[model samples]
Target: MSTLSYETELDKLLKGSNISHDLPVSQLVERALERKEGILTSTGALRATTGKYTGRSPQDKYIVEETSIKEKINWGSVNQPISKEVFENLYKKVLAYLETKDEVFVSKNFAGADIGYRLPIRVVNEYAWHNLFARQLFIRPNAEELLTHEAEFTVISAPGFKADPNLDGTKSETFIIVSFEKRTVLIGGTEYAGEIKKSIFSIMNYILPERNVLSMHCSANVGDEGDVALFFGLSGTGKTTLSADPSRHLIGDDEHGWSHTGVFNIEGGCYAKCINLTEEKEPEIFNAIRFGSVLENVMLDENRTPDYNDTTLTENTRAAYPIELIPNCVIPSVAGHPNTIIFLTADAFGVLPPISKLTKEQAMYHFLSGYTSKLAGTERGVTSPEATFSTCFGAPFLPLPAYRYAEMLGEKINQHDVQVFLVNTGWSGGQYGVGKRMNLTYTRAMVQAALLGELHSVETVVDSIFGLHIPTRCPGVPDEVLQPKETWEDKEAYDNKAKELASKFQENFMKFDKVSDIIRNAGPKF
Candidate 1:
């Protein structure tokens, strides 16, 4: 299909009476129920199951091989390539399948919150709930902004349209193909709404960097005195939990860009994990789930109330809501250059320090390392903690080479003179099975101490293995807990465990051969 052919078909679909453009939340919820797409929970959140595919189908994701971006992308297993023809065929198929639907949902909005850097985006969905998901997850344009909005990137998602792996060059029935030349994303065969959200993130990760903005997968917040902080970590590392402090105004929960002027949110809403969510533990996120919010794969009780602790469907259960729902959220989701950067890690090995200040070299090393751990029983795997390192804390969404983003971060840190800290929220005395998880109260205290400058210029002791500058004591935390080695019951056992974990760090950092010697020496000494 030529550009004109697809444009004509898409224009016909958009101009039809069956197309619903920017329908209010109430009507979309009504349409979803009428179509039996999902059920409304007692809290009025629309609960939708994603069938067998409850999470992202990374194996089926691809980037079209266009000449312009061929040399730019980090082409490997992480970024699989498909010919341009395959993308065009799939794009046509998705659009054609959407035309056959009784109604299609369209949403036009922006990605970045900063007016100068924002990317105008449009989302076309085959399901009403999906449109609502897009509405709740992406930026919602005001009436004035909508008047002149022209989408720079358009996403077309048709979950009912499955690809033929053999015929369509897809790995499976699912496909998430992005064509950089077309500025279009085509997603199919996955009812999981996160695909719709992350697809645009992938686009921003590519586009923003070219515009001299550093795109990041992190949560940000602003303090009372106007200090901005960034929390970087992979899933289950308490990035969301720590960033949503009632004392601080949230800038955004995920996806942001650091432009020449300052930092700005790339999303208008938050997609929070709802598994085991409780009001006492996370009142902000819990209360945010309301009439317009979309709840994915969450089980309901007999009274139609959400079972936050239930994981029968999936532990990846989530809540999607606009940023306005959070009482302490910054309206524009913009902040100044970060005064502090915290790299969070759930180190199940229990070897990393609880709170350790980082040098610029160490910060760059750990930022690129992006280390975290996967606890046992989290997936279908064996019962043990597995070390997981995602470069820059977000490997899957980054479209460019890892070095591109790392170099950008190094420059930003140097220019801003940002203070960086590595905080371990996973384990303390021993490894996962033996040692318990870090105390939430103590973790909060340590984070607060760092944010408030309580630990700056404080007494410190360097770790023998990891070489992290650990604070001697924190305000509300126990003195012994400050040193992980002191809390261990067996002295010799702790040494062996620490050495094993240190060696893992050394091995993982080996992939970055091009990294400067100063940054390389910042890793574990073992």
Candidate 2:
């Protein structure tokens, strides 16, 4: 209602609480407004409180920092005509933001001839950083020229994006900057500044002169006997919690890339689920948030902290906190190739409880399945057991071709000889509303077995309905819970529920039937 600068609005946003308790808004604002004069001649050149390297190799000296408009502020309320010229005319502002800084790293990318900015840590917010590494903003770049350009990092902005293809065809409101050396990124959209945190860990790890690593989408950490189990799943699966095991040493969670040498984390922070989360249920994750955590758009309490009990705002709650909060967070987020790669599913029918040992065909089947329930308030309102397809794990946010990455994965599994398993983190024995969620503790134990290489040896029965191989005994889980059962308060109700879920899976998979016969058979066998 009153005239206010973008700084003023940023002040309010900074002071506001995210789902995570503390977000250094003032610190972020101050840095965002800093000067950008000096040139960075060093190998790597970005410096936040923790500082980072932006070079591909030891000798490379990329642009340290750049500038842009602070678009998150609501200019209409302030009577400022919405500025769409930001993408083209924000160099002065970028310099002003860089004026206060000593050394920083920035990257730029060109797709064909389309140029994009990879803003320094200052201009990009924590939330934006999250989506960047999630590969949500992967653009089709001019690979030939990109290789020629000295500045391999650049940021971009695409406004008014609605994740729909038909109605809002070619319409999206997303801005992101990607890094080549660190292979990290920062992403944001109009409604939200940054929805997910990616590239923070691997970027930080890249700077450190320790383990040579690269960021990935698979979750891996040190487990029993120093064996690390890598958990790979589509969204809504329990990759974060299952990998955040207190009993094991956590390397990193979510988004890992592997090579002949080692594995690395692509995120600077952790983007964790906050819907109905409690300290008692996930102490490792609960404790990870404190000083460096940035809570994203969650309803706060009088104390300006997350009210986990309160669900009035939005259930798509998320927290962005530094990985250092995890007990044994390793810098340069790298580890030996995963001993096990587990595919996770949140089967709403409650019929799939923690299955394991997916054959290569089954792996490709579920890989293309990309199943997960949509958030209640987000896009299409809460619907019944929705089956979405993402090429590898994420289809919306990737820079490289989906099949290229998938081929890489298939090769890695063969080369490194990594074992793969499938686990459902959602409801079991009953549907979502009707059945209780399987204990996170049980899921953790089953994952531990997979990582420890115990589940790989003893698997036998083929599940009648899903056609998945069921392991007889998964160290921590009882034998009976291996297969999903149609158990409901009413027998007819169970039949109807299973039928409904089956139908949904069938329809979603029908389109991909040409991809493979296994995936063609992904629908409920009955």
Candidate 3:
């Protein structure tokens, strides 16, 4: 029989609750079905709904201000500050609430694939399904490693426990508080499984940079010749889908750290957006959705088969599966330095070219701008395609200042002589409503050309307003499509929209201080 030694320590924290430690997948699945927390789809995958919060509650997230790392944090609207007293008080309440629960599921895992930098973490979930999520998302340890493991950071999640805004100093009843001093994260009032994954990512974002490691919110893949390429973009920009290329070995679908040695994946799994998923488009991700995968807020048909097209539940429908499930995954999830970096944007305005090479300064400018269009229904309250700027392509999960990550990225690009490209995965002819979405085949061909360095020898034209070098020709792409303005019937309309987006870029750049003149001048000049 396996020992329950780990539970003894957790039992003291979650007093009075029936502690279920390191339960196997079968047992956890049984417990989840027994409690009706989730159901098994015909494919044997577990389907669960995260009531009230189908997505991350970014507004409710907090970082406790303490003496140890008060100034280190970029405290503002994004990284909200909570007094140490508030964290302590709420911490006690969360534990007390967990104690009252009938059962608690515990998962002990590691966060980084690189053992040297990996953080040992323990996650305590109120629902068995959540434990299953931790199992699929985090790096699992063997029996011997589990016996001797000690968590560097711990996450206590009880979605059933809602905070009192007036008393707990939170924006709402939902809260996700990270205490650096206590080395713990307390999550309540939100059952979004993403919270569990992102909490660890936030911690790593803070911890990794301090160690001179550049933590990135991007997807990575390695070519046959060991060439590494990074895809940086926000949620809807196809980072996950594009990086799962059959021609390359996927390092990871999301979250990576670039150190002096190489790039390492911060996660052991891929949490892919499942809405509109089709087997013909993404055969690998589609095929990986069988047993052991956890589907969140996904709608199902009468036969209990998942309806990837259905958004009745949520547009943020996701599927979490281990990286090994991907046919072309790197086992250790580590690779040498990246040779090329692609910044992806879903440009709803369609004024941006389908693909453009970026100068060093321009790369830094776009990295800080991190512009992407959020399609309607991707998140609650988003009714249309809205242009959004998230620094480093993932501002919400970043705990440090935006410039720190940008600086690290710039340094890496210079040191390694990396080629950078800006690829628009958004619109082409006019705007979101008027222009058609960029054909996936064309996008793939452009990406392939960029990766293969075929565009280096191609003739280029400078975008007058945006100051971007647009390639006049690519191997498989039409010459007319290379120039976005030429593709539009009304050239004047394209000019107007391009200038408008340029103004928005300038306006957003004003928020950052102490940026170099080179980066400052790299924006659209209209």
Candidate 1, residue 516: CA error in Å?
A: 1.1
Clash totals in order: 0, 56, 0
Rank order (by TM-score, best first): 1, 3, 2
C-alpha local distance difference test of each model: 0.88, 0.48, 0.89
Candidate 3 lDDT, 1-526, residue by residue in tens: 1124433444586454388888988898899999999999987889999876887777888999888888889998779999987877787788777777788999899998888899999999999999999998998888998999999999999999888988888888998999887788989998889889888999999999999999998999999999999999987798889999999999998899999988999998999999889999898899889888999999999999999999887888999998999997998899999999999999999998999999999999999999999766545567678999999998988998998899999999999999999999999988988998898888989999999989987889999989999998898898898889987889899989999999999999999778989899999996
Number of clashing pairs, model 1?
0
| Candidate 2 local distance difference test against the native | 0.48
Worst 10 residues of 3 by lDDT: 1-10
Higher-scoring candidate on TM-score, 2 or 3:
3
Ranking by lDDT: 3, 1, 2
What is the Å distance of residue 102 in model 2 from its true position?
Answer: 19
The number of the candidate with the highest lDDT is 3
Given candidate 3, what's the lDDT at residue 35?
96
Q: Per-residue lDDT for 362 in model 3?
A: 97
